[model samples]
Target: MRIQVSRQLLDRQLVDVDGRLVGKVDDVEFALDADGVPYLRTLLTGPGALGLRVGGRIGRMLVLTAERFVTDRPMVPLRIPYGLVDRVDSAVWLRIRAEQLPTSPVEEWLRRHLIGRIPGAGRAGG
Candidate 1:
């Protein structure tokens, strides 16, 4: 199916088959086939990709903040291969469930250090 990458893909919410939010389509990756045809490779989602796309002092701050949570100086975005995509409409739907995918490091850090520590954090709010 033909799709306008910028309009249909970028910034679109990514959802797993079980209806859990994975993340947004922060960036896209492309690869060339043996026939020299370019094709979508992966969808990148995470603070690092979003920060780089924003491209400014605010963007740099975002990258820095996320980086501090991990021992790795440079953080990599969560990459969802194009093959995993099941469909696209209001959101990009993946064939697998969210639990099958790797968790974002920045998200893990925030959940552990901040959000998870809050009272009632373990409970779903009304």
Candidate 2:
């Protein structure tokens, strides 16, 4: 299907099959086919991609803040193959569930070190 990347894909919210918020379409990857045709390879999401897209001082701050939680120097974005997309409407729906996708490194780090440490973090709130 033909789609206007900037209008229909970029900045669109990404959802899993079960309607869970995966992330936004922070950026996209393109690859060339054997026939020299260009095609969308993956949908990149997470702070890293967003920071890069944003660019400049504020962007650097974003990346640095997220990096503090992890030992890794550069965080990697969550990459969802374009083929995994089930449909595109107000959001891009994935054929698989969120659990099927890899968790963002920064998010994982934060959850383990920060969020997980808060009082009553293990309990459900009313």
Candidate 1's residue-wise lDDT over 3-58, tens digit each?
Answer: 89999999999999999999999999999999999999999999889999999999
Per-residue accuracy of model 2 over 1-100 as CA lDDT, tens digit each: 9999999999999999999899999999999999999999999998889999999999989988888776777888888999999999999999999998
lDDT of 1: 0.93
lDDT minimum window of 10 residues, candidate 2: 66-75
lDDT of each: 0.93, 0.91
Model 1 residue 101 CA deviation in Å: 1.3
What TM-score does model 2 achieve against the real structure? 0.88
- In model 2, the runs with Cα more than 4 Å from the true position are 118-126
Model 2 CA RMSD to the hidden true structure, in angstroms: 1.7
RMSD for each model, in Å, please?
1.4, 1.7
Q: What is model 1's C-alpha RMSD? A: 1.4
- Enumerate residue pairs that collide in model 1: none
